[model samples]
Target: MTKKKKIKISELPNFDIVDYLKTDKDIAQYLTVVLEDGDPALFVAAIGDIARAKGMSEISKKSGVTRESLYRALKVEARPRFETVTKVIHALGMKLSVHA
Candidate 1:
């Protein structure tokens, strides 16, 4: 029998926080949690977590947006315009809000 490979947390790549953020499922879940908790900071924190996971520098380059702009848009007090939100979400491969 082959020896089982032991994986270490440190050895493993960081979780794909950006991929999670980019998915509709994740956004839905986050929205649900936010609605329940009523904390915009948590939402901003989540976005920041994803940005860090995906390498903010790379994301900024690919998204045609500055890292500082992204951070500002995701900040707790930020009132990002719909267009700005759309651009960020699209850049991140996420979908927008829809009414059913």
Candidate 2:
């Protein structure tokens, strides 16, 4: 007979995806995967993660959107407008494209 030991959830190290998004390729790949999931909220959250990783202050300046607005727009389950998304993408040095 063997006894199993239980591990406490609090013992696990904290993990933040933003910390791993250190390069353009990494951010692109992450966003692509989120898009493939076909969930708008998830995609929005992914963008928010990348924005945080890249610095919300800089993104807001480049995107011409206020930092406060960006925060609200990118928050979880937020339904930001297309223009806002495009602006943020441009600020992040990325673009959107379509293909059949």
Candidate 3:
């Protein structure tokens, strides 16, 4: 019989937000997929995921914006102000575009 080793919870390393985001491209990909799907709930969920992936707490701190405000701006059917959108995109290392 083989014996298995047990690991302590405290022994686990702290989570690295940037490292996780880099490794998991799903956050961005999922958002794109949701946008394609055109489902409001899924879109909102994707926005939340992106916000978390981009370190919403940190971004909110740096941008001097409340987390709730950020969430509202990212919600489906939200017509966020140009400045707010710019702040979010800049924080997430993304660019915004428009199409005809």
Which prediction has more favorable TM-score, 1 or 3? 1
Prediction RMSDs, each to the true structure? 7.2, 1.3, 6.7
Q: What TM-score does model 2 achieve against the real structure?
A: 0.91
Off by over 4 Å in 2: none
lDDT of each: 0.66, 0.93, 0.66
Write down the TM-score for model 1: 0.52
User: Any runs in candidate 1 off by more than 4 Å, and if so which?
Assistant: 1-28, 35-45, 97-99
Two-way TM-score contest, 2 vs 3, winner: 2
Q: What TM-score, computed on C-alpha atoms, does each candidate reach?
A: 0.52, 0.91, 0.52
| Candidate 2 residue lDDT tens string, 18-77 | 999999999999999999999998888898899999999999999999999998999777
Whole-model alpha-carbon lDDT for candidate 2: 0.93
Off by over 4 Å in 3: 1-24, 39-45, 77-79, 97-100
Q: CA lDDT of 13 in candidate 3?
A: 94
